[model samples]
Target chain A: MVSVQELLKEYIDEGRIKLDPSVNHHTITVHDPCNYVRKSQMAFGDHMGDLNRWITMQCVDPSLYREMCDDPMNNFCCGAGGGAWAMPYDEERLAYGKIKADQIKATGAEIVMAPCHNCRDQIMKGLPKVHDMGNYKETLYLWELVANTLVIEPWSEEEIEKAHAARDAQFERDGIEMEEEEE
Target chain B: MAEEAKPMEIHIDRKNRKIGGIAPELADRCFTCGTCSGGCPATGLVPMEGAEGVTWDARKAIRAIVFGMEQEVVDSKWPWVCTLCGRCEYACPMGIKLMRSFRAARTLRERDKVPGPIHKGTMMNLERGNNLGIPKEDFLYLLADLGKELEEECCPGFYVPVDKEGANLIVTINSKEPFGEPDDMKFWWKIFYAAKEDWTVSSVNWEGVNWGLFSGDDPAWKEQVRRIIENARRLKVKTILYPE
Candidate 1:
């Protein structure tokens, strides 16, 4: 029942997680997953659902965030929902995703932040490469961006040594050897 | 302006009135509102072959299902075109499950005619304990190997804990990661590292996608669920992160 987006919201709200949007530095649009946003429990009695109010916005700079024309509950599907992503219909799913592709293109965003596995795959497969705009956008998981921009305590040599020791123990414990470092 | 309009025939096959005879609540609910069509992303995209150029519409498809035109529904390519996103179902004032109905309609087709990749993935899930059919040894190797690579790259202490008993989190991964882009696995590892969460991925039945559900293959879907459940039980993890 606990979604990562809601968790991210909680972390940011409590001031435990600080995000620097400039680290990502892209005009980004959120691709709400059907399962998490639309199929999940609804907002305070609003039947149509409020997807545009995605709490994930808390992790990004609102000014840089772009909204898809038909967003949230009313948003067009990426054509990968309902297990269709695994369904064997390639041309059909690709055709079905055209609507989503159009929406992404209209936003002019360089990145599409899709948290769901199916959504990420569908958009990646559906983004047409023939267009000048196609193949330029990067599909990223919500957490990837968060991790990419996370302000971490710089790795001191002491920490690095400890990490290397742990890695060595793991390699030894798991019966794995490090790949040889090439010259 | 009206020269006695001919009365339209209202046909309903009582014997075949229900959908798969499992539940028929929405069988007679569609009043041909066309709202579901408006919300569908695939509505006007793909058309059935040899038909007058018209887009796929859920209301019309549902009407066909309700009236016992099962063969026509199955024959149409529009069934395949449906993303099953449930947008139509969500938009339906009648609250009909449009996607389930489409899946039921899809089942009416011959097993051989079902979409190929999903059909294969479904078979693979039953045979190999996951959709991608990743071998157990290789899966374990990749987990250890990738953990080393990830740690060297960005995550300093990163190690993909495999089959670690009594871990707090039992996270299942998308098969796409191990079978294709291995680098993506590091994203979750980084998050886990930042949070300092104790997690492990099972060496057995590690794939998170159940394509059997996509093809309406019960035994295959059940098999997938059983393996994940057994792995988690065997590992004695506190919680599972199977997103699907």
Candidate 2:
């Protein structure tokens, strides 16, 4: 039930870790499973997109993010949560997920970010079969996104030099003067 | 004149205090707002033949239950088709528990009459410690194989240990990992590897999913949980991370 991203944020605030937000390059939209969030009544309220947005933005460019309609607790169940995927009623299950599939389709984002396993399974399986998100990538867990993007150790010498160069170039482009070095 | 609602034959089992999984006390709570039905993805989502006049949506189902039409609720395919995602229950201002009622209603049906995989999964869970009904030997083999491959790829010499005594954590795994989606398990293993987590998968009661919970079998659910706890104790692990 914990938002590990928020935990990572806490660690960052405490100066325990550094995160590189540019780790992800995919255009992403998020799916909030109903179990963890119950439409504004539970788990940080209906717009988990707020949290998801911040978290995803932390891993990738904010411009690459997309929001699905009826997000957070308002998000439709991808028809796979609640043990429905294991059930035998495939046709009905697919039908029940039409709204969810439609929502995913509407987003048109390359990757549908689903933080829960069941939701990811449902969306991954059903989106291609039931909806038309065939070429879209499989869903990704938020934790995986965070994990993949983490700056576990200090930057390499080459990385630091490149970063400084990029920073000075950006600042120069913005007509800002560099601070003098200590004597 | 407004059309009078026709009452049909049915009555509550007062001794049971509810039909299926419903609380008879909440039976009278619905205000017939159609809120549940409006939010539901399955209300009229299915075009079943006999659902013509039957009540299946949250509000209408509550109305029927309050009127003691418990049998009708039990009989509808709505219980199976509903997916039980539990949106209506949370959205209900009255705090109606629709999904559990549907699940309870599902359980009320003859065990043989329940939906296919759910019934099978529950039976398999009770009999084989997992819904996949994979024999212990085969399960172990897959774990060993995958662990060896992963160990070679990342951790070099260390394997994905199973039933390691006194490990810091005894972790359960979803059967789906070993059955349909083995690669997904790699994701978690990498994390554990990175963190140097002292965790071991159990050789028995390793299934994380409680199909018993899904199929409304209380005893089976309790038994499954108890088995995992037992495994943790036997291994003397400090923590038990239940599989999600």
Best by TM-score: 1
Each prediction's DockQ?
A: 0.41, 0.15
Over B1-244, each residue of candidate 1 has an lDDT whose tens digit, in order, gives 8799898686767466545354575846887888999778778766755567965688878887777776777877667777666678778888777777887776666667776577787777777767788887777778778877776676665677777789877877888888998878887777666665667878777878877666666677788878887888999986777643
For model 2, how big is the CA root-mean-square deviation? 12.4
lDDT, candidate 1, A96-170, per-residue tens: 777788788888878787888888888866545422334236887777777786665435667667756765675
Worst 10 residues of 2 chain B by lDDT: B151-160
lDDT of 2 by residue, A69-173 (tens): 654665677876657787777787787788877777777788887767778777877657766663367678766676576655433557545534643453354
lDDT for model 2, please.
0.69
Please count the clashing residue pairs in each candidate, in the order shown: 0, 1
CA deviation > 4 Å runs, candidate 1: A6-18, A41-58, A69-71, A83-90, A130-136, A154-183, B1-11, B15-22
Per-model TM values vs. the true structure:
0.84, 0.79
Provide the overall lDDT of each model, using Cα atoms, as 2-decimal numbers: 0.70, 0.69
